[model samples]
Target: MNDHAPRRANRIALMIGHCAGMIDLVALPVWVGTLITRYGLAPQQAGLLATLFLGGAVCASLFWAPRFQRIAPERVAGWGFGIAGIAFAAMTQTSDYGAMAALHALAGLAAGSALSVTHGTIGSGEQPHRSFAMAGLALAVFGIFILGGTPVLVERAGGPALFKVFAAVMIVAALTSVAAFPRRQGATEQGQRSTAHIDSTVWYAAVGISCMGLVQAMMFSFVERIGADRGFGVAAVTGVLVALGIVNLAPAPLAALLERRWPARYVVLAGPVVQATLALIISHSSEFAPYAGATAAYAAVMIFTHTFAFGLIARLDPGGRALSATPAMLMIGAAIGPVLGGTLVQHAGYTSLGNATLAIATVAVCCFARAGRTRAVLSEA
Candidate 1:
């Protein structure tokens, strides 16, 4: 009935979809731990399973993104989440490594397809930075539930319960998408075909975001194990994760507030430095206090910086095609993170992750620097 109502509903739907789609960010620590403790998998084996999931997501996103304007995003989003729901439901039924691996890939494909559409729509908003930050704020709240609850659920019901939760969340997203997913303007969609194809800047931003994702996912996937190996018990470790979720709440809002003050370029540049520093501390610290502090703050770097990058890219590419590749941009490096990190931890040590983070962070900074300042990027606020 009101003009603002549809936009509000769209934002809410995007938030729900994001929470369901980005499960790796919220559940990786417990997910990896479950694979190791419950299924008797080696660290690399467990990390490979995670990698398979992200790789599938990357594949799906890259395929669907360029075709975004050609298709009905709502239908695609609904069907994607539905398929993911089914896959995760099946995942709850098996302990077989092969079966689980297949299911994880299927779920990632569906989830990535859905999420790319979700992010594209958000990028099409009047203020993409604020929209992304809003979605991220919701994700942070969801992270609180996930970070606090998943370990206990696994403790009581084993790893299958984790898939059950994923299934439920996906099912809910599927349902909401049918009625709430917003469609882009037809004239804009028609015009996007001609001009939006120049993607050099988009690719650079994507690479920069992906590098940060690599560091985030690598350290995140192992935080639980790292803490346990250092002799911190489950309660203490989980407390840090919960604290991490709580800390996540601030960055999005902070990014939103800073939009008027800080230049997106400077924010993007600062992100990798903060990310690598926190990651080094998180991986190398034997002390619980330092590890807890660093781990709690680490993810905030990506969240805050990515809020700026998402906004910048949306400004750079108004057609939404480039923004539609959100999953691929974020997940390409993430796909390698777990397996690479596990290999490093296996042969080298946890401390090696710090070195890896530094390397990745340097790459991210370089990419972000090249992303440059468009007139739109400079005019943010």
Candidate 2:
């Protein structure tokens, strides 16, 4: 195989696919907000609708990952993008909240499939790290879309039209992926045949990833609430989130450097520990400087932690496409975290929610530390 063949086309397709996946999420919060206004649903009910979307993703991922392994990765990814687009397009015609929720769930399912298939393809490639780096770059780009694009789209086109646009984007991405990705022989024909066993090491990585996801969900969902509690305006709250995203862009390079010297586990563990500390500080302080600093630290920690977890998982299961399983598990955790954290904030306030996040981060650090040590010893042997 020409390992050094032009991956630009494939990488671009992958980026587009990921962006399509991300656009679904970008559309969701605003869509939910619109539903609330249109239907006058209770806050909890609205939240449940959002949860259903993520819950469907979590449920589908369990089945989707294995199926992707059974099918050609490229085909699975293309179909995923296509399905997502179709689902989003369907959303434009729905007025019933129930129908909308189901459509969102379908979109989530498609996104989950796309995520697994695309990541598996990248992992199966020759230079996996570069592929991962490209994935990260895609994530960063989509992060910008999530942060800035959704609101603008909602304002200009309204929710239904916005979803239609998102659907069109997914369709384009699916076509590109189908054209760009290499054709694989067959599912059973490629990779090692290992039983679908969840090893302790993988579980540890999952837990770590879940914790990181929880922290991220809390930050994204509640940062504005926390800032408002501290007497900051909406713009100030947005600034904190924007700053976090900007600062987060730095950790990919930092993680690459750290991977050369330190084991992935150590770096992973350290990220959560730092994040927990920052969470504590953010919880206690209302000052603008301190809040900004805490947000930046939290952002850096999250990026490094995720980078380490993904890298470690990829390294540990290099023989097969098992790394695809990690994203599904991670997405499940991500789905749960926001719902749980949002509930906590509603009842107990931002301080309590922050404390809860810190506690989760602490547990993650311990789990990752143990796993890191074990991995190091195994590597040495």
Candidate 3:
């Protein structure tokens, strides 16, 4: 058995898979904006549309991840990426909200499958951390592309044209996955079957991840609206998102450094606290410079939290299925978050919405802290 072959194939799959994931996310805000502008969707309806995508992802992951464990993971991933690409292409032709929603849901389902299979492939390898780091790097680069380039693309190409471009990208990613991913013999041959029950530690990690997702969804969904309400223009909002993407790119290496120096638990706990403080500061200040600084801070904290929580779950679960399940749980919370945040914004405005997010962050920090302590004590015992 050539060990290097599987590992190399896994790395390639992770990079392509994460690129696909980012394309899905990058399309999200733009899709919501399209629904609002072209279809005259209310903010709540736009939020719900985002929620529907996430909800579909959650359901698909929960039902489909285990089945992939029984089938050929890499082939499943290839098919998923292809389906997602086709779904993106279909978006260019649809003006009907129901049709768009259904297609987006299908896209979400495919995204979930790709994510699960990619993680499963990476997790099967010996040096999972290195694989995860590579995956994180891909995510950061994709974020940079989406944040920095999407606005320009939208301006130059228009919405339909932008979808066409992304469709092309997705098709390329799908084709690459098919070429690069190795054939898995079977799920059982790859590893042990994952028991379906959620461990308490994994549950705590899931909560932390979900809270992180909630904060992120709120930021992505309303950051522009908040900036506009606070007297900044569209360019400023795009600038902040781009800055956030840059900050997200910086943290993968920083997370590697911190992981070398400190325990994963400490990094996980600190991230939410930092994010909460930044959110609180942003809630109080309406100034553009201060808000931008706060937004950068929020971005850094979110990157750290997301990476740490994901790493922790990967480490805690001996069975790699936890990788798939953790993200699924987080996506469920993400599905719920934007709708709730939009309601708060509708009734109480952006500041109050920020406050609500801060409260959630605080609770998340406490939960992570408790879980960390419990893990420490068990290790000592």
Candidate 4:
């Protein structure tokens, strides 16, 4: 009982840290407008800041995460969160665009380290699918909480003051890492050696994830406008979004249950196909009900696919190095998707937008399927 108690506490702590890091990333866009107005910076400058942060995160995940097997994940995660919190706190003192951008990148690097360690731990666990599902649940709950309160927080506290809260959250994440990460089995770092080889499938998985991200983001970034174009009012669109949030919460658990009963390969393969079909349905439908239904279905499939993919990568490479790249690939895909969607919408309209995303999703689905086949061939040989 005593041994089990610590392990359980560690899991909870790790989940909290993961949730905190995700909140920080997702909440930044809410503050971009504030940064522009407060600093007298151009829109491009604000965008550049975000880009730098993401770039830092991707770099850290690539360069730092692989070393986690040697260094204790607990220590790595704790220091990362601690330093990131300090950087964010310093950000509150700066109004200079250059200074803020640099600090934000620093924070991003630290946050990425935390994320890499957390993901590594989760993905390499006994039940990777269920672990990821729990993560999705945590993210869904945190997202709902923040989305509900963000407007009020900004209005009452003003935008800049929220940085302090972000800083506090990072500190809490750091503290929680103590319980969440594995304790060192040996006193010497040299004793903690890892011998796992990097699998070729990792790169394929990264490509597949990027393609999925592109399709999902393209649709999501312009969803509100798409509804507006179809004659839906702001209220109706928002109502759908709210309903979609509720809908998104269910799939994680369902996927977790499915993981227990079905093969992971089938679960992963089905996601993109279902999402592509949903995109097609949305494309043909003009009515609010159909659009809303398609949107909700897409949300569910997206989560299911992501959870499966992340788990698959971790299971492929137990060292967690491969999973580290997941966030970077997803971000890269999402960053580019909106530009493509915007251009397509201008030239070809919503139907083309759907078709374009569907086409990309098709490629993504094929990538995963091919990867699966390749894995099977290698196993047989």
Candidate 5:
């Protein structure tokens, strides 16, 4: 019991940190809605503000990732979340758009810094695939919580209530992490040493994952709009979003189960193709049945595929620096997706978005294939 307790506590802290780091996905709707309704910002303005958060996160990830070996992952995580909590607390005091914008960026930077190290530490664990999947599962559960509860809380208490809730979450994660965050494993038994530099395969893998992120953000940002534009009605659209959230719970465990059965390389290769197909369906389908089904399954691809990718990258680079840069790779495309998708919709229409996804998906497949070829060499090393 004594030995088990600390391990259990470490997992919970790491899991919670993962969820908090990725809070932007579930919290984005509330953030944008609050900005538009409470602060009277235009949609474009709200989007740019959100982009500032993502931009800050990307910058932090890129800056911190290279130093993964030098810094204590737990210390970085604790300080990052602590700073983020302060930023969130500050947000509750302001209704000024400029002030809120700066706070969002600060929160994002701190959160991203914590997230990068958290992912790095996980990647250095005994079972990287299962560890990342567990983190993914926690994020899914957290998603349901935020979706079900946060909006109602905000409705009753106003937009500032949302920031208060965010602050509280960050503080809890910070305290827990500092108290119990686990140390990463030393270099692998197979002689995978901690190298300052990773090879091209890791870069290829990162590019492939980034392409998928681009597709997810580009299509997902407009899913409700697509449904509404096609006369799916409010009830139907809401049902899809609700179903989507619930369905998200399955992918992480499923990926863990399939870790041995499915080759990670094949999964990475297949993910973007599957993602592009679903995006096409979501973008072009006039009928509700097809659109709802595709929209619900859309995010699952990234979650499931990323679990495998994380494991594979950890094996290829035991130093953990590449995995630490996970946030930057994921968010680089995401940061640009909304603005670029909107431009495409404004100029070329929804089909153009589908076409774009196809092109991007092809690029992802090619990159993954190149990475796969080298995996035969590095994964064994």
Candidate 6:
């Protein structure tokens, strides 16, 4: 095989992994209610199951990332996907809540292992930002398919059947992973080098990532209520959601095109400002058309910010050490968002929630600006 073959393979692996990871994560929202209904569990307990799954994934990703050099990434990812497929399928065999949670946790760990491999592939690429954007685009396309097909599947065969679907997808992903993700020598070499100090750029990116998670989750978690409070009916709210999902697909390609002409930093900096502005508009708008427009803008900008941040991290640290911890930051921020946002909405109101999101967005913008400036100065020096 040609030397360039591995790079091409790695790109394919990343695309598959991104799609699989998105399906695994997004499936939770559809199943959370089903878990409560079928298992006769309390709402809190059902939520805890989902949380435990995410917690396990984050911990596994963190633990396995540093060790990728020792263990071949392809091996790790292939086996991880196989194991996850088995675990997901096993969930259908048990009705016990404990067993379900345990199985889901195992799935999470395997999923994380697979995810680390894909991320490392992207981070080590020549054009990491472009690779990340492509990955995002792949996920968005897959998400649209899922959104269209899942409701029909659920109606025909209930929620647990979705596990079987995920399992089949995982199995397919596992089969291709070995060919798609060859080991990269640069990653192994970089992993062996000693590191003593932290980069300020990494911190700025981390905080921005955390803020992205926080505001996105907070807004999404209560989007329906925001619409309802504005006196929109169920059909109108559903239309707005559908519109947002469809519109969200545009950003990755747009960002890819824009980044080729303008600095990627501009895209990163613009995202938060755009999202904050849209949040304020959505919160204040009572008209359906205005609300839909603002929501769509928020979704598009949200994708840009997240993809840019992850791509930036990869470009800064190709060894994938810092990039490995990003998912944890996101999980932590997302886990906190609902609780804090709920409290603010309860006591203060939606206006307070909007203000809080704006504050976070401002901080993210400042961090991105500083990080970009620091990079410029270092390059000049």
For residue 257, give model 5's deviation from the true position in Å.
1.0
Highest-lDDT candidate = 1
Ranking by TM-score: 1, 5, 3, 2, 6, 4
Clashes (candidate 4): 1
The regions of model 6 sitting more than 4 angstroms off are 1-9, 24-47, 93-97, 185-198, 222-241, 277-287, 338-356, 376-381
Which residue pairs clash within candidate 2?
none
Model 5's alpha-carbon lDDT is: 0.81
Whose TM-score is higher: candidate 4's or candidate 5's? Answer: 5
Of the two candidates 3 and 5, the one with more favorable TM-score, higher being better, is 5
Please give the lDDT score at residue 223 for candidate 5: 74
Give the alpha carbon lDDT tens digit for every residue of 1-381 in model 1.
111334767768888988888888878898888899888998899999999889988998999887876788888889999999999899888889899999889988999999988887777656678878988898899999999998999999988888888899999999989878886546554234426455577688889999999998898899999999999999999999999999999999999988878888888999989999988898889899999999898787888999999888877787677888988988998899999988999999999999888888899999888886556566766
- Would you list the C-alpha lDDT of every candidate in the order shown? 0.86, 0.64, 0.68, 0.67, 0.81, 0.67
Candidate 6 C-alpha lDDT tens digits along 269-315? 88777777787777677788877788756656766777767766655
Candidate 4, residues 137-236: lDDT per residue as tens digits? 7766665555345535655766566677778878988988865565645422222223546777667767887787767766665565667668987567
Cα lDDT for residue 190, candidate 5: 26
Specify the highest-TM-score model's number.
1
Tens digits of per-residue lDDT for model 2, 69-170 = 557767777888889889889988877877977887887787777777776666655656555655565665565555555545555666676677668878
lDDT (Cα, 0-100) at 220 in candidate 6: 52
Report the C-alpha lDDT of model 5 over 1-381, residue by residue, as the tens digit.
Answer: 011223878999989999888887655655655665667776556666777777788899999987877777889999999999999999999888889889989988999999999987777666778988999999888877775676568768988888898899899889988998986444444224665457779999999988887787777766766776689975677677667778889999999999888888889999999999999998888889999999888888889999988878877787678888998888787767766776687678777889899899999999988888874433442
Name the candidate, 4 or 5, with the larger lDDT value. 5
- Name every residue pair that clashes in candidate 1: none
What's the CA error at residue 332 for candidate 3, in Å?
1.0
Models 1 onward score TM values of 0.96, 0.84, 0.89, 0.78, 0.89, 0.80
Clashing pairs in 6: none
The residue ranges of model 5 lying beyond 4 angstroms of the native Cα positions read: 1-6, 33-38, 154-156, 184-192, 228-235, 346-351, 375-381
